[model samples]
Target: MTNQTSEQFWEERYRNMTGQPSGRPTGKLVEFAEALPPGRALELGCSRGDDAIWLASRGWQVVGVDISATALAVAAERAKAAGVSERVRWEGHDLAQSFPEGMFELVTALYFQSPIAFPRAEVLRRAAEAVAPGGVFLLVEHSTAAPWSFKSRTPFSTVEETLASLQLDESWEPILVGAPKREARGPQGQTAEVLDNVIVLRKRPA
Candidate 1:
């Protein structure tokens, strides 16, 4: 895929899909959210709203964002179907160009894979800035250089390498940063080992 395609590429991916992809919230996100103070939450790259809708069901006001309008439309439909439409807001946004402005008590980006040509550091920095004080910023990204994703040409950066590139302030404390192996069901209905890098950062009160 060309670097210029960006969001349009993702939009096409969703447009062709028959329905939302089936997957539960990443383990890292569930763990972090369980320990976090509940309030307004933002979900970046929320594909079909599973995680965002789950959070809303737990009483947190949620905003789910994605680069694809098709995906957002599906997510909105899912929210309405689940009877949590009032609790979640779905927006179409391109993170590579700009991040939405607003302080949130918790912000999460799960499985946000970047293209090799894009500057991942810049995107991560912008994500960090979006967190409100005393808030938590969680990132769960695929760490495995799986053969399946290789064909797509999406760049997968290791957790350590991405963290090192960030110029985070001293107030930002690291809660967890490492690659964890988890059991996941593959496309063919077989269980497989999945490696994911998780980072949880808490912004200290200024």
Candidate 2:
């Protein structure tokens, strides 16, 4: 198995990547954000920048971070083509070593998992702290493996389980938390039912 934690592994993956967009930003991001006013936003593991670009289009100044330089390059180009380059920035980062600077009105980690072990809980703790006063941190993750997935990751934690582990302070309010079923196409266009664990939290203003 490839060591996903190493930059070289991701660099190679992105370098070999050849595909259309990673599909449009999920309805989840648009639905949760459309109601809220836009401001600075941060997206972790922002692979091909779909969600980040969508947020930029919605008038947020977005900073997207990924470990692969190739991925960041692609994201930058995508933002440019969308005519939202001025509203978004892409950074190459290994989350365990460092993260982008500055607090944000919204911080998100969508499907942020890896085959290689990672300090996901600690990273999310920092993600919570990165939210500015009155800001929101939205987490969306797969609750199970894809029907055809070959990667052997353990079943993902439920929304309730992840929240319980976060151990957030009283300053945070849970806006929404649940695992919902959705229909989706696999890489080969086969149909599958997938469960998504979604959690949205808002930080109380100081």
- Which candidate comes out best when scored by lDDT? 2
RMSD to the true structure for each prediction, in A, is 2.0, 1.4
Per-residue alpha-carbon lDDT of candidate 1 for residues 26-116, written as tens digits (9 for 90 to 100): 6677777976657999888899888998888788889898888988888898889888899998877777786776889998888876553
Whole-model lDDT per candidate: 0.80, 0.88
- Clashing residue pairs in all predictions, respectively, total 0, 0
Clashing pairs in model 1, backbone N/Cα/C closer than 3 A:
none
Off by over 4 Å in 2: 2-4
Q: Write the per-residue lDDT of candidate 2 for residues 89-197, one digit (tens) a residue.
A: 8988889889889999999999887766778888888888899999999999888777786574666787888998788999999899999998877878898888899
> Which parts of model 1 have CA positions greater than 4 angstroms off?
150-155
